[model samples]
Target: MEPVLRNLRIGRVLNEIKKVPNCMLLDVGCGFNHKFLSTVEPYIAQGVGIDFKVPNVSFRKIRAIQMKLNETMPFHNDSFNIATMLAVLEHLEKPKQILDEIARVLQDEGKLILTVPGKRAKPVLEFLAFKLGIVNRAEIEDHKKYYDLTDLQELADQSGKFEIVHHRYFQFGMNNFCVMKKI
Candidate 1:
């Protein structure tokens, strides 16, 4: 994971977990990268990591599920204290739909934490490719769209089921930190 993104997630998650106890967390689009998971090991009672493919890790404590983002989450309602989607929302077709599902599965007043690249963060590379008449962006990369601060803020506000507890600009707001609480 990139340092800026990784650190931002770690910091936000730690702060959020401090407010709750016996926490069970759900990590969406967890991939194989579990740095943040390891960081919260002390506070987490049970952790579930879901991705399209399972990463090779020997730890049996962390439950990794293979699943698609656009479908229903397999867990029961109000199953977790916190749900995290790190560097993942931009990859999905209906991000708000996913958030609704997250709200469904999380306890009332549960927390959702996520991070995504700000709209301006990678514009230079994208623009240079345009000038060179070449598409350098990775096709498999899950970034369907990049979001500016206002877009993210609006998404948080109109998320349908959750209240934006805290939203901050990261990496100069070219990246964003969003904390939503289930209403």
Candidate 2:
């Protein structure tokens, strides 16, 4: 993942967050640095970041854990008020199941905000990664799928755990931003 592009995705997600004081947040695939969590620390009361390689430690109001997203999550039900998966949905082998887990851990009507490469980004991302050498080749190569708005909506629908609240294409339509409310 390119740093600028990852931050762009994070920015788009940030716009969707409703500045709720004391928000309990769950950030999936927060990477080793928890950059996004760091940025949103002020608005949230506390946060938990889960990733395959996150440092297993606790910060002031944030916790980082090494957790495999493809498996079941470790938290109890209704553990979070907001959950985010910035640029992460497409990397999962079991996207639907992961979405279900997100729903399961969220409080009723909690928001699940996520981003992924939109369908139209495929060729451009490939060109950037494979030819231009701008994006991370291994990262783009690892993506299992690209999603469109309908794909996201359908995934949310199929889980029967979320309702589409908002969605759009950003980054010049190369990326998708979706907000689903837990049902």
Candidate 3:
């Protein structure tokens, strides 16, 4: 129903947000509009959104910054209570480094909520983007990889920075949802 799936991912992230107390959030790859940040505005005390392309708009509780996720963030250690990388991991060239950086910035035991397309979505996504012309072709073309639940668990285990506290599949098993706590 949505274009490939932004709304579904946002809903999943919001559900994870509700499990934690009010927090200062770091939203990785918050796009030009800061839709997710805006949607969660009431749930967070304040927020910082970073991406390679973000507008200069200044919202009341958000400071949008144009920065690359591959580089270390400017925040101090344990700077945020929660960090989210909704649908952003698959596009990163160095995803583990980015996750490590996220872990560095999050307070101890803080949560990292993320969603990535499942491995099964490869052909489905390709068809939606190329044939049906529904999903964003640019995004599908940019995906570095798709992951399964085992892949996610292994990645987090290898990082030694986070533990996948909760995980589930949604969108008819086309996507993965995870709540990882900083170890």
What are the models' TM-scores? 0.83, 0.96, 0.95
Look at candidate 1 and give me any clashing residue pairs: 118-174
Q: Which stretches of candidate 2 lie over 4 Å from their true place?
A: none
In the predicted model 3, the residue pairs found to clash are none
Per-residue accuracy of model 2 over 1-183 as CA lDDT, tens digit each: 488887887777776664655799999999989989989887788999999988898979889999899888999999999999988898999888998899899999999998889989999999999999988898889999999988988898899999888888888898888889998
lDDT of 3 by residue, 1-183 (tens): 453388888887887777677688999999988888998999888999998889756778888988888788999999998999888989999888998999999999999999999998999989988999888899899999999999898889888999999999998898999999999
TM-score, prediction 3: 0.95
Model 1: lDDT of residue 56 = 43
Q: Which sections of candidate 1 miss by over 4 Å?
A: 1-4, 55-61, 124-141
Ranking of all candidate structures by their lDDT, best first: 3, 2, 1
lDDT of 3: 0.89
Off by over 4 Å in 3: 1-4
